[model samples]
Target: MNKRLLSTSFLAIVACLLWATPFAAIKIGLKYTTPLNFAGIRFFISGLLILPFIPKFKAKLRGLSSKSWKLIIQVALLQTTFLYGLFYTGIDYLPGALGAMLIGAQPLFAAILAHLMMKNDKMTWTKISAILLGMLGVCIISLGRADFVLTTTIPLGVGILILNNIVGSMGNVIVARDTQEIPPRILASFSMILGGIMLILVSIPLEQPNWTIHPSEYYFALGWLAIVSAMAITIWFGLLGRKGVKVSNLNTWKFIIPIFGACISWLILPNESPDFISILGMLVIAFSLLMLNYFNKKRIKQ
Candidate 1:
């Protein structure tokens, strides 16, 4: 394999692991602060941290068309506002691992949306089957208990999270196609700043009047999100730049994030243990991801 491809693959794996832990972090942080406030502070810190680095980042943004800027805004809204908001809120009701699994459906949504929206991308039966298997896995994991119907709120939250994933997948397609002309670093930085600003503005009305971080644990969570999550995004886009968006989509292995998130939840929160069906669901998800990678590789070769 090429050195760049190898390095990008490694980075993608690391990013997935870092992201997986975020649900636990968010769950912990929520104890100290409201979701909107927590998300706002984290984004602000991340946006500011990248400021100095932004000047050194290189990618062509000299003559972006108005259409491109509009697309970037759309990407920011989908990724930052709708997606993150739903995710954070969902974590309040569901285990992080479960949340991750729910969001794991992104690649499936991406494949479907890409087929409809993009000219180059097409949906194949293999992709459709992979999506179906993945969705079945998620259902097994998420709703396979005798008291399954008892977790009504969780399903609602997961529904929003799924929508978040769909929007994110759509944004990924946009970034993949458009960012080819723009610099990844520049685009990442700008998107973060824009998204951060939007969150701050949104939080003004939706969040508590006097925001405060209660426990010191909140700070740790914030730090984890700012450094790990934000940095991973930068790294993700960088990898995307070197490889195409399709190649970068492989980063969805971070889908295991929900699994890690759920494990942490079982330890820290009052979450129930996974039943056999849920465990089976988890296996199905893993298998689906493996198949996705295999099919993606085969498609590339063909």
Candidate 2:
């Protein structure tokens, strides 16, 4: 492979693997905390952790333009609040692999949204085919198992996760426009801080907001997730701002996440294992990403 391709692949792998970790971690955390409360505290702490990296944190805050502030809040509400409000809750009812797999479809959604919203990134036939393959991959996963019986919770969980990804896709579009205008770290910090606060407020009413952790696993989850949020968002947004990377191209890396999530879940969580059908489905999902990203790129270059 070319050196640049190798480097890009490495970065994408690292970022996606980091993201993949949170599904199982959240599952562990939710045992001791409600979904909302767990998500709220994790993001809030992560946001705070981002402050020391800023050149002049306090001065930057004071100097922020009103437009910057508004963008920050808008990102907070759309990216963090609305997206995660569904995600953390939805993941609760899903198998770790399944949930992560669904979220991995995000690029497909983003591609469609970007084509509709951004003039340059039009929906090519290749992209449309890629989107259908991705959706089919999701369906295969959802429809897996000869014994797979549908339940209210499972269906509801799927619905919530789908909604979560849609909101997240929209966030990507919004963030992509202003990515160069604002620092990724600053945006990650404030948006997370504000969104975390919003989630915490919602948790107080819905989940009573568990303030303590007894299980060591809950602490692991919280700490890991916080770190993931801080690091991943910073890197992810920074990547999105790169001159040639489209939202879909950058997001193709997301396919690796479900693979990591499933493997970790199977290894650590005794209760979850991938069936043959699900394994097949996951392969399909992974291939769809290749179709959208790798092959598409090759064709464009050719």
Candidate 3:
């Protein structure tokens, strides 16, 4: 493989690994800190980590048109603030594995949104089938859990999580379509900084001034979220720029995140194993990802 392809593949794998660990780490960390606080800290750390690299970011912010700024703001809100806020809050209520599984439906949402919003992108039967399969898988996983029966309260949490996925997927499509005009590195860095600021402002009212690091485990979890999850996303955007959005979508292999999180939860945390239906759901999601790749390739050839 060429160097670009090799680097792209490696970055994709790294993104997946970092993403998978977030659920487990968050689950552990939530034991000590509030979701809002955790998210704020994660973003802060991520911002600090990337500060040194800011000089390398090539986008000419001053020269950007108002339209571009609008696009960037929209993306930051949908992809960063709304999605991450809802996701972290949902994680407070659900297991890390389940949260990941639910978010795995994002690509399906992206496919749909892309077809609707982008004239160049059309939804094929193959894409539809893959999406359906993934959706079914999520249903199976949810249904199989003995406690999965509809509780009015849990549904609220799940609904928020689902919304997070939808917004995130839409953001991805928007970013992909717009990358021709906006440099991904500039977009990613600015979005992170803006999103971090937003999260901190929001958290000020929601979270107390308890900046206490009560446990060493909390510190570890924060470190992982900051260095791994947040920074990994920045790296992901860079890869997306180099590889193209469709190729970057292949990073959904990070769907393995929930599976890995689930396994760790079962082994290390006091989390329960998913039922047979949940296992089926995971398989369905995996199959859907394969179909997405297949159809995406077929469309390119046509």
Best by TM-score: 2
Candidate 1 weakest lDDT stretch, 10 residues: 141-150
What does candidate 2 score on TM? 0.84
78-134: candidate 2 lDDT, tens digit per residue: 888888899878977777557755776787888878877777677777777766676
Q: How many backbone clashes does candidate 3 have?
A: 2
lDDT (Cα atoms) of all candidates against the true structure = 0.68, 0.78, 0.68
Candidate 2 global lDDT: 0.78
> Which prediction has more favorable lDDT, 2 or 3?
2
Every model's Cα RMSD, please?
Answer: 4.1, 3.4, 3.8
1 or 2: which has the higher TM-score?
A: 2
Candidate 3 residue spans exceeding 4 A from truth: 1-13, 54-69, 90-102, 141-146, 239-244, 247-254, 263-283
* Residue 189 CA displacement from its true place in model 1, Å: 2.1
TM-score of each: 0.78, 0.84, 0.79
Ranking by TM-score: 2, 3, 1
Best by lDDT: 2
lDDT of 3 by residue, 1-302 (tens): 67765565566766776776676687788788667766766776776677566664544666678888888788778777788899877755665446545776676667667778767556667756766676666556645553433444577777888888778877877776776576665677667667777877788788763666478888887887888845677777766555345522443455555555455566666557656766776787778777777766776799
